[model samples]
Target: MHQGDPRDGAVTGLQAGDAVDLGRGTALLGCGGGGQVDHMVHALRVALGADTVPVVPLDGPAHSVIAVGLVGSTTVLEEKTPSGRELPDALAAVERWTGRRADAVVAAQIGGVTGPAAALTAHAAGLPLVDADLVGRATPRIDQLSLFVDPLPTVTAAAVTSSGLRIVVDAPDPRDLETVWREAVSHSGGWAAFAIGPVDAELLAGRAVDGSVTRAVRTGRAAGRARDVEHLAAVSGGRLVARGRVLDVQRGGDAVSFVHGSMAIRDAGTGAVVRVEAGSEWVHCLVDGEPVASTPSCIVVVDARSLRPVSTDRARVGDELAVVVLPGAPWWWAEPHRTDRVAPRAFGIDADPVPEPGQRPARGGVR
Candidate 1:
């Protein structure tokens, strides 16, 4: 095992305490989408015996890496808990499809419970958890995964629900895989555990978003020293966009996507109107009718007083909130192919992507 820095440097293991910090960081990174971070942390400890889970750096020895996560109603995932075998089964399905065995597991996203949950999947499969992830933040679409960002020779999507329902989709197009898996999830008790890839180290090297796992842990640890939200923002490479009360909440008009809606916040100091447009996750933000932030750039909203991150589905009128903008993974915007797909317009919101403010944290939180 490699040993260098406990938080960053060539780390080799993720202690249970690091998992707790990771949950806290994912809550902040989730931006108002991924929820139940605390719950996943507990589930990880309970199912895996609260022990250290080995961590593998992206540049570590060559191994096949598979990304794992849950999809569908996180609400239902909460009520009827998963049995922890779902993802491992999905992993098996992927292996069957690819005729290859996986040596490690990666989280689909580090934004919510998926980070910890994927870590659990790694433990259950007796594989080291890769220190990388698919999407660097919370995103609703499966097509947006880093693995899907590029064309793979034998990429497959395998899913299994806690109720024993299972599905596997192998297609040339990522959209086809997304649609089929989503349809299966709709009938499989609302949530399904999924595994993507059998990606070899060479291909994974060019595709995966590196260092996201360590970034989440570092961000979470930094939050421990944060005196307030402002201090947290200063350290976490985020900027305050709005500090006010929720004035109104807008719901679906014609497009009934998974929770497509908008929230308006009235700035307490300048009285400027801040509009947050979202579907599945907070995707766009506007101030006085000018686009300030858009999809792929996290729009994190939190309680103005306690600074605890708020969930998008839970936002309502009369809530005092402070909104922050965190830089998303740069991989999405690094190429035309990836940018066009992740842009707001791709999600049906008519707006160009707001130019990224600057450098995003490189898997180490803030700079």
Candidate 2:
């Protein structure tokens, strides 16, 4: 209900049209991962026949918040459509386990589906959705949450397997939260509806990535008018790193990954080889074998002409593509510890955080 502060910005709420734009925006934010979310967009539209899912202030006057997201194989999710009980069931289970009702629904992370899904959960629970997210960009791991990285006190998590199995965990160590929950997901064939929180508003006061909801909407609008990938990059505050033809697509290295691999792009202008790596999300891009752009920056690959973001799975050899690198949320880069959690090193890639997009030459000494 807190709305007056200028820091919260002007985001009022999300409507049906906003969902379409948000889908595109989140897909871009997904950074060559988070599955194509047209299905989730459609679901949000249908769910919001007329009502606007209320967007509460990020640093609003809420007692506590519960964040929500989906985990598992997106492909399986598309095939076995949800029964509409997953979120409600998961929310209920978490509330019961926590022994307190949530005042707001926060997005655990924003991407193609997670953000919209969290909005849907807010609507179903009759609670407002906070204009914020745990992760500024879609990421592969639960541990990437700002809450864990920033390390606020008293975090609780819960999940409901697709089979309706409920599990709750209160870990002293943040990494164990993912370990315990992911182990439960493995039992459900790697899919579940989840909730995390009762995170007090005081913890979120200055730590949560505020205005993320609005940023997604702005990204969606920018993508809609983009005449080309470069146009989208210019308007969206990202740099078009490479305009190229996809030379190769390598399937995920690990079995549990959503869409992970390295795609080799032959820069059309310079002819230098560029390799973009991923493990559920774009990790970093190498320009002529030199790491140029790496997380926690957002790396995007889009169809060159249509300007639509291309997820890692759909990319194929011979596809014309443009790779863009966007500045990471300032919160991640503000400190060494924060960056350590999201940097390529955190994902086991033996690399350091490179200079931001502007500082380094992209491919062939060209940005």
TM-score, cand. 1 vs. native? 0.91
Q: Residue-wise lDDT of candidate 1 within 117-151, one digit each (tens)? A: 88888888889988888888887778777777777
Q: Model 1 residue 284 lDDT?
A: 91
Q: What's the CA error at residue 235 for candidate 2, in Å?
A: 1.4
Please, what are the lDDT tens digits per residue for candidate 2 over residues 57-116? Answer: 776777788888887766667776666678767777778988988999888888767877
For every candidate in turn, the CA RMSD to the true structure comes to 4.1, 4.3
Compared with the true structure, the alpha-carbon lDDT of candidate 1 equals 0.79
Local lDDT at 322 for model 1 = 82
Number of the top candidate by TM-score? Answer: 1
